[model samples]
Target: MFSFSRSPYMTALFSFGVFLLFIFLQNTVIYTSLQTVFSTGGLCACKKCVMDLNDDDWFFMRFNPTVPALLNRRNSAMRSDVFTWWKGLQSDPKKANFSDVVDVLFSLFPDEEHHVVTDPNRCRTCAVVGNSGNILGSHYGQLIDSHNFVIRINKGPTKGYETDVGSKTTHRIMYPESAVDLDNSTHLVLLPFKIKDMLWLISVFTTKHVTSTYTRVRPSINAVREKVMIIHPAFIKYVYESWLRKHGSYPSTGFITLIFALHICDQVSVFGFGAKRDGNWHHYFDNSLAHFSRGLHRGDYESRTIHELLLMDKIALHKGV
Candidate 1:
């Protein structure tokens, strides 16, 4: 019979082999877990699409300790600092009974605390379609529609422009000033700049008494009552403070919509943002010249911030020609 006792060399070789096998098994488990966590049918299912929690800026923008994204009954009270900053956005900052307003609003709409729940086993892909003129001839309709969620900003018509701006609208982000009718399937996301804005939302579905804020707004909107969602006042202030760094008077609707996607989506792709090569700013739907600098927002700074986000690989921009 051969001797059973192992030599020092043999023992060392056996231990090394075991160590290598252990490492291989460990790596396999890790890769499998990652696949399950980030699984999706879209481009953002890859490892790179995952937001880095370790990143300070991402952490600050994404995980707000004080502010929640959407307003519900549980988080109805507005923080003092957030209220002060938000109320200053409009001239008519008349104090209204916020709790009472929300109480009636929730009864009309869904009182759910959250809309999109982040899940490790799922990946949500979002397309933020802006109204920039660059998207005119891009023929990105098919590509834009491919996303899980397609968000269109203020009155971006898709009837004639369907080839460029896709017809599929999962969410519409608008304030009362930019309000548009929505189909049954689409979510009507209202970004309230004032307490009256909230009341306007309530009135639209009920009284139809509150028609105008600073200007005349639609007394009744064509939208599914249950599908309506209001952005939290604190969230608006949070974006202004954290993301914009107070660069502009407040974050633009486009910018706020982008940030909203970042919080709820696993992968975000932007379309129709920025000016054309000719350096003229206009909406894709018409020949009218639109100026980013003309509004209350600092469009230049917001553009630069968007570029910074692109540099950070946080979002993919489809610069349509």
Candidate 2:
């Protein structure tokens, strides 16, 4: 004990530090796993997402609002760098002029037939629903159902939460990647990835078996009985590519879906739009009733941004969020 005078207290402190390090490592690993990368369709399994190309557009598409502004001047509103970069995924991977119309088409997309919900009589009211924890125990189901059309985004399993979100779902928007299998009463609106996904849907309903392409998805033969309809992304891309992207950070996948609802529907009542791990967006669950906003974390900044938007009537929120 005389030699170097090492204290037992120091050793105990070192052990505590090691315990904290263990907790930090465990939490870091779990948090990383829970965060699923958002893509147009469920999760992407594509090599290069198109082959021979590697770029992370979805990440850029998330935040950093200025990117759109930089693109606004171009015909397609995409900088040359972006254009050259995502060229492979564009409609005509060969021609630049063919794509010039891409942006303008998005701008004039409303004129396209079947794009706008043109019952001018029904244009005044709209509701934008999210997975926000605020919807639970709100009894907003009847109110939500009362709308001219109900808009749901990335939402699945409409069983117990029907009261808060609404039992009657008119138009549910989703990319095939995240499309939840719904009953015949609900429509599986196909949000296409590129021409391929859209064509795949049509082919399924009309002629071919897309099941050959995907196993996780139910065959079109089965889909016919289920009443599925593929929505052209042009309509959505047009609106978002025009105003929303320029104004805010990348519009939420759900929020963009809601704008389409507003463009076509009237008198909307939002519910359960921004749910979290706790399932509180429409806490009407049977197992446990939770009340927490769906954030990257318990109280992430983006979650707050979305809430402010909801409060401003840009969208709607539940009490908890």
Per-model lDDT? 0.81, 0.46
TM-score of each: 0.82, 0.49
RMSD of each: 12.3, 17.6
Candidate 2 has an lDDT of: 0.46
lDDT of 2 by residue, 1-321 (tens): 453338787778888999999998985564444343322222233211111111333323232212221011232344454443333333532232524434433342322333232222223444556665666677777777766556677544457777777777655666544545555555556664444454445555565564433325534533322345444333434434543433332344555565455344333345655554454444234334444333212323335545644544434455543
At residue 157, candidate 1 shows an lDDT of 88
lDDT of 1 by residue, 209-292 (tens): 987888999888899998988898888888887877787688899999988887777778999999998999988887798778
- Model 1 residue runs over 4 Å out of place are 1-46, 55-66, 93-95
**Residue 214 in model 1: shift from native, Å?**
1.1
Off by over 4 Å in 2: 1-112, 115-125, 132-134, 180-187, 206-208, 212-215, 221-252, 275-314
After superposing all C-alphas onto the true structure, candidate 2 shows an RMSD in angstroms of 17.6
- Candidate 1 positional error at 277, Å: 1.0
Q: Could you tell me which residue pairs clash in candidate 1?
A: none
